[model samples]
Target chain A: MSPSDSLAATGEDQLVSLLTQNLPQSARTLHGPGDDCAVLQNHDSSSLTLFKTDCLVAGIHFTMDTDPARVGAKALNRTISDIAAMGGQPSEALVTLALPPDLPLSWPLGLYKGLRNAARRSHTGIAGGETSSLPKGAPPVISIALLGSVAPPHLVLRSTGQPSHIIAVTGRLGGSLAGHHLDFKPRLAEAQWLAAHGPPSAMMDLSDGLAKDLPRLAAASRTGWHLLPDSIRRHRRCSIHQALSDGEDYELLATFPPDLWPDLSAAWRLQFPKVPLTAIGTLTNPDIKSPPLSGGWDHFS
Target chain B: MSPSDSLAATGEDQLVSLLTQNLPQSARTLHGPGDDCAVLQNHDSSSLTLFKTDCLVAGIHFTMDTDPARVGAKALNRTISDIAAMGGQPSEALVTLALPPDLPLSWPLGLYKGLRNAARRSHTGIAGGETSSLPKGAPPVISIALLGSVAPPHLVLRSTGQPSHIIAVTGRLGGSLAGHHLDFKPRLAEAQWLAAHGPPSAMMDLSDGLAKDLPRLAAASRTGWHLLPDSIRRHRRCSIHQALSDGEDYELLATFPPDLWPDLSAAWRLQFPKVPLTAIGTLTNPDIKSPPLSGGWDHFS
Candidate 1:
């Protein structure tokens, strides 16, 4: 579709590319858009700041009747997952709420309770917040802007994968919407451990399922990829397609050099005995023909 | 009103107090909520990072027929004003957009145009952004999270005003919604100037109007205040009541020591001759009686 098409026709990815093209990027922006988080050169000489924002709307991310506390937890956790994807630790967050003025205060208070618990557990400070009234008949929305910190050596990026890299995913996937989406644990400690240990060549979070997210990581790394047949680890009662295409997994997806696999696997098993880390695929040279790929959840399509 | 009351009954300020009370505040949070921005202690001891977020909703901040570009600019500028309020220079921003899937692609592109121009002018980088499709019949929304940097000596807060301090504001107030709200320039340079020379004891932006915002500053500073008779500088064709209560003025409200007013005012004229700095009030002892103050814009009220 052309740029003149509606957003539904253009789709989220293409629309992002079109809108971000020629964006006014400052010299301080070490990495701009297209990554899990934007990396900015802060005053600290050794560390970079990770910046990301995510939003949840009533009737979209959650129903109006959904528990307000869960809604708030999911909103902040979504952004924290992005920080984890970059091997960064969340530092602070700013929350913006848009709701109907007539709504009971308990809704936001409950939302904030969820937010406070999630942030406290993650060691993220709630720095500031703003609230605005939505027009009549509009659904409520919660948007979070998070700042994270990462040492330059520990910073993982989506554009650094190479051919022969083994693609691995953390934990089981699929059927997350049953309840997991509301309370999925962001793989922050695991990602940090991976970065401090073998340090994957490239990494990102599995929010849009392996089918969609894997290809994105591949494209960003300037490589192609092929998933091993029946290699994906699916959740109980979930089909293989669901494992490959269901979104909101909030798990780590990383690529490691083949040589590091043996030791890294042993260490990962020891470090995270309860969490499963599965090798799913390998990055291939961009020039090579890629295997057929299934599409995942798309917001506008 | 009780905390259990509806948002409209509790009002914006009381609701904010309820929601943010006992929030997760990390050790790195040098200054938390109740200010224009949160001051975080960065690794660089010489400087601090400012974090703030603000949002705009269709049918509230602007109508569907309003220029899309202006909407975009306004969204980013509102957050930037918070940064300016802290005497900081904006470094980067993360934008989150929630819109209908059927929206024309040109709408977002135009919005980006406005965001790009405003960011370029302020030397702020658009770091990363996210977009989500709103459910059917949902209004469009834009939220911006901005990061800014301030040197230690230049950092300003809203809780430092003292008795007898001169309450001054930059530029004329009121009548901003007559097209000015959408395109008004944030007083970044002027604020940075004030922070550098005779840095105000307390400072904030006039978002909710002087009548409301002034008392907020006074309360935060643990002081009472009185407006000098006929001292408010109103926009052309605006009544004094409008000047006192019309919100979205987006001007700087600061308290400075009486001793520095002469030299500071003269230097300000040299630095920003086109902008007027009006002395409208004075901080007073908390025990003193305050004249009846009119309330300004309240989202819930």
Candidate 2:
């Protein structure tokens, strides 16, 4: 078996298509497979019930050369980002570490330190995990299973956008190659804000770059997307490709009703004065003749 | 990683054992790693909570030739056994399946179906699970997590036996190599019965053969055990080794006060006429030594 991206190696489109094709109704699951989190109905929590498992492969996800703490932070951050996409607040986490016997004690401790610190900052608990020592040659694999809860009516998902909904982004893009990927925040507060006030429809995190991830959310919602390329490229001033395809931005992409555009910007600007939420595009009724955002990542094909 | 039994291969035991040697107190957890279930205080629960997790690897635990349904049943039953060891009723289960794409989908479906059947028989809910395909060439692994409940304070555990406790077992043992390993019940009912009525001081399921697992329970309680080899062998008309080590009998093992023995057996006879609860041995406060039951199956070791 390969990562979800690998399925796309046959082509990214096919991977996403296959993911949703055979999904069981999962009635017990208020928000199922397609969303960043699975949701449950709770009057106390309009929040989406976020659940995600992210595995960090030694070679693919990170190398030993990477700082142990940063590696740990990255793992937790990635899972948090998934919950963030659905506007959920993380409540608990489980970290399963599969390490080779040769790894020094300092390594895992560093990783744990990083995880513990981040959990503290996020106000979430690292509930528990399993630790295993693989054979000498086995790669270190760390998998994090996170559970989060979000307010229901405020639960923003990737498949709720519609044609004519304007696309927007929270915070600037690009420059993750400089190591921001390992240091990024989960955008939890921003997501909660969006859910409470504007409550944008069709939301997701920009991890594999907006260019790749945007199209995914768009296609899932079965709507075409239009972007103001100049606006995005102009703000970053970096190579447009970096702004488009460079992954791990950890920003939020959301769609909003045309009438709420001003309030969306005003509210975003008022709250996170420094982190700008910029309008990037509009959703259109998709057709066989058109595609949403842009191409995406594929592993196997 | 090497299996759990391969503790010395990587100098990890110094650390793993160190972390586990003396457990930290948790206000919520009734039983930690030393027992099959990590019992928690569920204030509203009219019953005791029992939780456990077990993992199955492709090459290590089972192979493609093994029936997929059996694999599924094994995963679920292993966890159920954990609860049974605590004299608890099975409540709910969740499965996490990590597969290789090369394997047939039919296998996974069969596993799901079999697991569902097992859960149904246990009268537990299929809470749902997260499924993912691992990186290419990774062995297929299945892990089942279970949640169960027993009458509060009646949940028997490994560390509670007394020196004067009388050892007892339910049902006959041996001949399990005849496919009993693949289709074993958790002995949940017998466990509950003993927990509530027999007044057992300690209880656990005989899974890793009586020899290996019984020692583990004894060690946890810091007690010594004296086995009745003749009595055990006579009951089954099998070799002492077969009676002691031929495992997967899935029998309920418990210890109680000597005076309770007659009533316990009589009650068991009335409640489950087909299964007899008979005395086997007694706990000892002294450094008692008995022959090893037999190292039944520690493949890696």
Candidate 3:
């Protein structure tokens, strides 16, 4: 039964009672369950591995017509991006699918084809997955989990962005809706180069458009940012809303120092020419004069 | 928008074309987008870390009358149990939620309470999660992904049951309907203890009922099993169908050296006494002449 029925009966206190009352101190976890990925040290090396998984559903996140391969690519890329945002190299991934009974075998098989195809291209394998069929009316859903590694001391993170840093992005924006959203590759190469070199100040992927997301990096670093509209990619027919609210542009939105701009740009072409790089803004300590922007894609808002 | 609208768009080959042609070799993923859990080794580690995630929807996996906390609990446990079945320890987790619009603000909030509550008990944390609301007609859905560690030099797997090994389970079966299904603990502690100590031969969580699950395990191990009916628990009122077909009993069913029974029981007591332990059956060393069990759970069957 739903929690309300229990609430109507035993009240909320019973809720905790029904849930485990005494959890163990947790012995085997080296870093335990709250982090970008489960942190496990490589006994023989100076680095650690990072892992994560994410899910998106059709109708809930996208329509069925969304390219099956991009859906697969995005699902895989999103998790890999998590590893990248943390400044790690993604080396593996797994996908699980939940389909409605009416779902065509080919639809999910297509999703897998997309998933495996993306995996193979990345030198990733189809580790394996479970395909479950749900009752009618249930939407199509896909979930993927990925694993990657980084040298010990330099995993980049949202909490790492600091005041007085410059915020940077790789690649142009505003045109993701055309066909790029589904086929974008995660910045695994870019992240590896940055990690092996040095921290990029603070970083995150611009999945949700930058207008709203730039501030999150700012907030995570406890800083505020200034963006010149002129520096951002803008389509003639697209409004700032599209730039601010559109999701699925999996490019690296990172922060570094102004002096590092030359190095960042130089590194992008020599190492990652297939993925474009750009400078979108700068970060400063948040203050009364420049309030932080909190206007991203709030699910409810 | 489904592939259903375009007959020309269906087929595994079509999916393969969309996915394979555009994959990049730069990602360095040893395995991606398939397998029970993506297996990867960083130059840093000698062993592999397993990652996975799945979603449970209200009205689909449960009803409105279900405990919101239990719903949250089950969401995490479902995946954790999957890890347990593989004899791994879940070290980190992430969640994504899609809620119904116009529900009491307390709804999602209460669900988070349940989520954190489970995390606390499971020794996991809230980590990171995304929340969004769907226009009406969307059922409340919660998705969770977990990052886990398998001991180096050895990782227990779901597809590696052996012939002639004993199949043992901790806890009674066939009575999840008695309210035990909603809030079961993943045998994380027990499974880890087993992995470190005895090493169950073939393992997996029993979610889709023993009848259906046993064969999958047997097939994975490349063997058949003879069930000792007396070893299985059952409710007097529970039909053979319910005993074999009901889903959502988060118990550990594993096979190992028959001699390890004593040590395994002691470990179970030290780790999961709230749950029972029993030796249920043995795996045949060779293709058996007669099968002890008649059937397994099949949604289509």
Q: Which ranking of candidates, highest DockQ first?
A: 1, 3, 2
Candidate 2 per-residue lDDT, tens place, A157-266, comes to 78989898888887777877677778888898998888888888789988777878877787779987777776673234567667877777888889999998887788
Best by DockQ: 1
**Which parts of model 1 have CA positions greater than 4 angstroms off?**
A1-4, A287-290, B1-4
**Candidate with more favorable, higher DockQ: 1 or 2:** 1
Root-mean-square deviation of Cα positions for candidate 1 versus the true structure, in angstroms: 1.4
lDDT of 3 at A220: 59
Question: Positional deviation of B59 in candidate 1, in angstroms?
Answer: 1.0
Q: Per-prediction count of colliding residue pairs? A: 0, 13, 28
- Individual DockQ of the candidates? 0.76, 0.16, 0.22
Q: Give interface RMSD, per candidate.
A: 1.4, 6.6, 7.2
| Per-residue C-alpha lDDT of model 1 across residues A147-195, encoded as one tens digit per residue | 9999999999999999999999999989998999898889999999999
Better of 2 and 3 by TM-score: 3
- lDDT per residue as tens, model 3, A157-218: 76577666776777667657676677787777777677666468777777667766676567
Model 3 regions lying over 4 Å from their true place: A1-45, A194-199, A235-241, A266-276, A288-296, B1-48, B132-135, B152-155, B158-162, B189-199, B256-276, B285-301
- lDDT: the better of candidates 1 and 3: 1
Worst 10 residues of 3 chain A by lDDT: A6-15
Candidate 1: lDDT of A11? 87
Place model 1 in a CAPRI quality band: medium
